[model samples]
Target: MMKTALHSVSYAGVWPGQARLGLDDFLERTRNLGFDAVMLMAKRPHLSLLDYDADARSRLRQRLAGLGLKVACLAGYTDFCLGAERPDIPTRELQILYVRELARLARDLDCGLVRVFTGFDYANVSLDQQWGWCVTSLRECARQAADAGVNIGIQNHHDAAVHYESLFELVEEINEPNCKIMFDAWSHAPVEKAASAGFRQEGGDLVAAVKKLAPYLVHTTVADYVHRPRYRYQPNLINYICESDALRAVPLGEGFIDYKSFFKALKEIGFDGYVAYEMCSYLRGGGSEENLDGYARKFLDYLSAF
Candidate 1:
């Protein structure tokens, strides 16, 4: 059975000009929304290591117990090769330490997973070198998490392992029992550039990607979005032309993504982990507490039906 979870980023108001709800409020809101668990943003205004000490962790655990909520995972923001821009920066070490501390907190909170990311590509570094850095750093992170009895999920949200094959290679390279893919339909969608990265031989085939990567999937974060074509006006030419597609978040099953196929694949593969919902970006309805709660419930109902 797949458990439903809500990411607190939906309520953190991290985006500018959005409603700011504290973590405690977010927890209570999630419980009211009827989720099985929650995936907390492991940063400020939430569960930052600097803010969460031993006593704080204890208090948080008690609060969750009272609310009947479980910490599904901790979302750790990291860019392993970000320091490549300036050799003096110890970004790799800092990120590793960050994950280590999150792992400790996960243990204290009785959570089993911490979600992490690879680095974006840097102009100053070769792609392969960036890949090597991520592999090495992720190995250390996996070791640290394993020591704390927590699992680390590598989300395909960064350039280093954005493609399905690249992400699979990353898992094989790390070869840690605790390291697994937090796969989602968005990244697995084969687009024009997927050939070079090996997402799928055929493009725009998300179901294939899900089926292919099913064995290594431990968690998945989901949100739906509609693509509005971006048009630019050339006043001199008196013509408007399409530039790109502006993705706007919508209630589940209302976007361009074929989530039915994606979820179907997960079910076919017997994926029994958390299916997390998030509104981490600009939402269709403005970010009000009522709107956020409404969207979260929409997602909950969608997952229940799915």
Candidate 2:
């Protein structure tokens, strides 16, 4: 059976002066919220490499043990092509080292997976070069992760290998036994759109997409969003409407994402990985401890139904 885990990001305030919780409190909260496992956000205010030393890691491991909680995975925030404007900076190297260290941390924490991203495409470099950078970096990271007895789950949250075909090719190019995809429905919304618009390729629709990607997915993140339309007033053009879509995060089962279909496909594939819930962006309700906990519990309720 697939396990349910919560991402620390759901409680880690992203905005200034927002709700903030330390790693310990976050873990305790997860336990209180009735989750047996958790995915730690590998950054400050929660599992930052800079913050945790040998002693700190020991204490965290002990705490998890005491609480009877498991570390599902370590979510690493990385963009391999970050410093493309300055080739001398060795941005990819730095990111690879970061992921390597994260793998070590994952081993120490008794976690099997270290989640990562394939860089974004906001650089001046060509797509081929960017893809090459990510592939090389991920291969090295996967090697180190394997050495540490950990696996690397390349999340489809970045532009470097965003599409399913591109991501599959990238993973094949890396050719690491320990490397796999951390597929999520939210990241494949564009493909769903194309499928809805009569694109009939195999696995073009959401259900088929889930089935096609299931074999490669080692982990999946869950979140729901509802689009809020926008309009721009134009004096000359009779109020031109904005083409861009705005999405607001909502509690599970309350958004536009057809998670029932997605979950059914996952079940059909016999997915045996962690299904993590995250509230990383602006939520439907205000961000407070109570609201966050309420939403988190609601996720559990939603998952139980599945």
* Clashes per candidate (backbone, < 3 Å): 0, 0
Indicate the TM-score of model 1. 0.94
lDDT of 2 by residue, 73-174 (tens): 999988888886787898888888999899999989999999999888873688888888888899999998898999999988988766677778888999
User: Cα lDDT of model 2 overall?
Assistant: 0.85
lDDT of 1: 0.86
lDDT of 2 at 152: 97
**At residue 112, what lDDT does model 2 achieve?**
92
TM-score computed on alpha carbons, candidate 2: 0.94
Per-residue lDDT of candidate 1, residues 1-306 (tens digit): 569999988988777556878999989988988999999999988889989889999999999999999999999999998977677978899899999999999999999999999999888899889999999999999999999999999999888878777788899999989998898775555343445357446443667777777878999999888767788999999999877567788899888677888888899899889999988888887888888888988887777766
- Per-candidate TM equals 0.94, 0.94
